[model samples]
Target: MDAVLSRLKGLTADELREEIIKANLKCGPITATTRAIFERKLARTLVENAGLTEPDSSGGNSAWLDSSGSVVPPCATSATQDSVTGEDGDFGYGMGLNPPEEEALSGTVCPCNVENSQSETQTPSKTAQGSPTFFYGVCPLWEDVLARNERAHVYTDKKEALQAVKMMKGARFKAFSNREDAEKFAKGIFFSVKFPKLDHPSMMEADTINREKANSFKSPRTQDLTAKLRKAVEKGDEMSFTELVWSNPRYLIGSGDNPTVVQEGCRYNVMHVAAKENQPGIVQILLDTLENPDFMRLMYPDDQESMLQKRIRYIVDLYLNTPDKAGFETPLHFACKFGCPEVVNILCSHPDIDKNCKNKYNQKPSEVICERMKEKGQFQEVKQKINEYLEDRLYIPLLRATDNSSQPVIGAPWSPEPMENLSPRLPRSPKDPVMAVRAFAGPLSPSKADEFRRVWKTPPRERADHFHNILKSDPDRGAERVGRDLAHELGHPWAEYWDFLDSFVDLQSSEGLKVLEEYLSKKDFRDRAHEEAGENETSNRFKTPSPVRLYDCLQKRGIFFSS
Candidate 1:
């Protein structure tokens, strides 16, 4: 003890201070108490640096630090001076930390040493504290020790291990066999923070957590039960559906419960199979069985959608709308395309259903039906039924004037962007009142005439252009000419006026003449005609409704002016 003190005293103050800083020991103002503390701390460091401790002989040996702060050789020692090796094998005080495990020295380094010139180097010591343990500088199975601290997380159970993993902010941690080992390793070292050093409670917490996990599933989705349930759904066995559901409340929680349950032959999950096959009852039962229905289910590799969006929400915005793999169609699109009117009706009526949602080809469900209608005459009724189901939400195909007046004109289908191709005559301004009216009118079907009539309240100027364009594009304009030829009958003084009316009168039969007299005799028409005659109405003939008005009158009276 005196020699150890003398050796420590011989160290320069700077060396002593360096040792104090290295071991992370507290250094207060030099006083009797603090000076004694420094001497003791320095003595321990010197003993460690001197390589006086026994070499490790066990296949896996660890540092055996003692309460008295001394190191001992791994070789057995007796009450003889020869054991200490003081310039010879002589007895010296040992750390007395751990009982010597073996009979002879195995020549392994026992403890860290000071005085690098006198100390012999050996392979770093390894520990027996199971895997994920660390040595002074070696971590054989764990990650490379990038950074370390004196404080280490110690856990008795997995619950504590996991919790420590979260609370401990380092990338990795070291395990210790006992609290004493942990305390010794943490002694006189710097650590960023204190970790929870817990015991048996951690085991209790782990057991409790495991029990909770087990209880979450009322019945485990075992192979037999899941297989039976899937078979029932595929076979449309209502009895099996009920039985399986009653047996395991969480059976339909997710598709991940059973990966092999094939429904309706496609790779889709059971919900999709039920929806595709028009099994509404099965679909409802499956939906009711889920705990968290809002979690997204896989449809296509690229698409993901919530169960509510799939079954209930009729309308979703573009981003949330996911299309299935087959044609990138949604369930509603599939229902309508496959002629599942019952499913279509349910999905259509859902407030969250996006009726106008387009498929992979950028075609809406209505467009899909219409396209099918062109190939299958039977689909005409289906189209009508779907339209009836969709009512105000239905899309109308655009119309253009055709040679045959009685036959409805079906032009190119309407799209979201109506101004994709504007007629050169049409102004580029999308907000132009005339253009909006034209675009709105472009998509109306002959069947939607009533809807058009109710909604097509264009401003008078735009309305006039709408009429002029319609009349000007009429291929069979003989009826319009017949009405125009009546200009001569204004009872005006012009020669051209008399000639025109005489020609029109010559062409009329007695019934036609009577119909013409009744139409021209209307008080509004007569008054307008008198005013027009006084002001040369022929030049302003383009604005006159006489052409369209007469056309309407002829059609109403069942008069055929053209062959």
Candidate 2:
């Protein structure tokens, strides 16, 4: 995930678009008539979710910054705050809902997503839990070994034998929740891979998420596949159109009620195929056919940045608004990174383009490139052109750090000062001050290393540093909490999480910061006491060396992060 983000940050505007194109996200033929579907939904989502700030022809801080829309530091974005938390409504998770309310919405389920219900049932049928492929987060190189090897659980988690269940009487698999639990709550076992079967409800969610049309209309498999193929063109599929659609020309477009659309089931039609293949030309074609109001509405922001409009907006903005949103991002976020001219042109020239568009990350198109240019050799002349075109010199915020540090971490606000959008210099510290998060729990970069000096603000790494400092102040409190937090964020548990705790203790003891602090304070207290000759001995001179050591003989390199 971090690598994906880094690459996206590294790409030029054009390259980012190519990356989007290569991601094969768009599908279906684009049509001239599709404008008829100009229902407010697509526009609404864009206008509502995307920045309404008009593009400044003169390039100053976008209306988003200084205008009425701007709020304190975190910048109120187009997407609602709840969207960030991933929990919209229904409080106290696992809490019961009103029985009457549940009954009111009964019988409303859609059936198109039936496959997942059955898929979940099929999990225990084949592979055993101990299988290598079953191990979550195993390095890719180890996938084949994990698949073929039978002893993954032994080295990783020696205590609990990897059990193989032929079948459970009733296996009700809840992929997300169960997966999270297994990863978080399971016996903290590494190589603890549990592939739960898909569930019916999850499939339904995917249908809605992927934008698969699941109306009552039905079409024969033959005719259905054809329309699906046609829809793929505008969505951006090219090479894939012929292969998928031609394979079954006889299939009718799904439901006859919707003659224009293919009858095939949702999510995996020719549009998907084209998207998978990055067929931009084909996407153009499909978009042409679905000339209905739904075309623009198809932007899939949350799921992998799917949809042609999103891809277009993402690519354009990265080249334009960069360095402002600290390369705090994924590939889609790079449209604004410095040094990518080719990409910027490709994105800017597109029709229906919103010059001030911000991506899911809440950065504008110009923010992408402008900040980047500030990093490398001077882009003064180009910056001037940008200023003239946008009508303002933009001041975007740079992401705090770019290393293995975690992003999206809720850090407290830095002192008041506009983070002038500028490229951070090598020891990549941002000129724009940001509120530094205090007391985070995660891995620290190597102490005193060059990267450490600069990347300290980066998450997990920075969090790791905070952990050590806290340990010095209070080992017991710090060590206890560090384990759980690292486990959740790093996706490690047991050996790895424990190892971090152990190492921090050792470092504290060896460096003796705790001891040094205790000694200094005690010495000072004793001197004061001798002078006063009365006050009770300084409350039991701060306890000395803590009792913690490197316990894991069985941990990986990441867990041992002494650096």
Candidate 3:
């Protein structure tokens, strides 16, 4: 018993596990036992099996004790013989003896002898066939290894063999075309194993060439899952949607070319699909699932937020407010445009919802609802609900006193310069108030604002005339159109501000003209506006801010601002 224990201790963890499996010993699942545990279990199984066997001719206690007084386990002889013959070896083929016989013969053998004998016996047959078969073998052991199987594996195809080795839990693999090489590898004598040159060179060369390009292609399983998810979302099948998304949270997080939720052409995520289909339940489920701690960890495993609840909140907010690629519209935008008021209300209730988010057209959810109401002659109630929600949540005081305080000026006072002298020459403005406002207001400097105020010093009726001319020349003939153009020109920093001005002040009315003039005349407003614009400028000469930068800035600001 002591000698048998000593022999078991000399074997590696993998060898111990292989012996245990051959002995048909139940050590629970393969993943449950550690190396020390495997040694103990195999040692106990061997002692018990030896007791059941009859004594040898020398009248030793059992067949385990030989005449030389050395311990030889019952199964060791047959295992050693199989290693040499290369027959009935367990190379993940399950070709070994049945459990009852296997238990009676289970024992440990040196890996080098096992590998060399098998290779010696098998190599001749392989060579005679001239098929150039490359035998790939792997034995998975312990939780550290990543193999799919708990036993050894042998493959003829190099690619299949390499893949199996990678999937092994222990991450250990050996591939060799030479018998001596295989023996060295099995004994852990070498770090690298080399394969023989095959007739078809492209098989090895193609993997290296296409490795990078292959990264951009989604796996077939992921593609299939995405297809099924889309179908469930489109059909408003909440049960199927939850089952698919919840079971595979990693897919929902999206990475590289495998966006779990989005469609191929339009790039609309599942949120957009649900909202467009008026699936309020699906939207609610998505929100709830995103808040799951386990799911959030998968989405943001390295989140800087240490608190689990806070990290989940951050992830949920991102998914809730994320916009689609095609229209730059959030799910809320789609809800207002195509879904019911219930869907809009549900979205609005989210703590981090961006009610003032704008799409590529610079239209907000309320504005989108209004357009839908006009075009389809429906969603009037939805529009009213969204407007009411915005008024309550995003209300900006209309009666706040405007400060006339002055700010310190930098550089020389503004002076008219030739368009050619400007680094990025300003957009040429035609001789019209509306086009001039569109072009000049974008590059509004403190000096330019003062010039506009001076020009507008005429009587209220005259100011009304200028405003009326702007209205007449406007192609859309809408106050909102002028506001949108100005907002688009100003870019994202003050888009919501311009929208606010357009919504509250009726540019078509004379009274609204008085309010606009008063607001523009404020010294503080001009200074702050110029300062903000200057901060965004890269050069002294004015140029339109980039749309991409504008979008990034707006996203950073969470797409909401107070006027």
Write down the lDDT that model 3 would get. Answer: 0.49
Which of the predicted structures, 1 or 2, would earn the higher TM-score when compared with the native? 1
The runs of at least 3 residues in candidate 3 whose Cα sits more than 4 Å from the true structure, single-residue gaps closed, are 1-222, 256-259, 297-311, 370-378, 393-563
Q: What is the lDDT of candidate 1?
A: 0.42
When summed lDDT is taken over every stretch of 10 residues in candidate 2, the lowest stretch is 56-65
Q: How well is each residue in 425-452 modelled by candidate 1, as lDDT tens digits? A: 4334644332111112222233453443
lDDT of 2 at 160: 18
Better of 1 and 3 by TM-score: 3
Q: Which candidate comes out best when scored by TM-score?
A: 3
TM-score, prediction 1:
0.28
Per-residue alpha-carbon lDDT of model 2 for 134-247, expressed as tens digits?
A: 222111122234322332211111111111111121111111222334333222243346433345587768867776443432334544345555554435454555455334
In Å, residue 502's CA in model 3 sits off its true spot by: 47
Query: Can you give the TM-score per candidate against the true fold?
Result: 0.28, 0.16, 0.30
Tell me the deviation in Å of residue 345 in model 3: 0.9
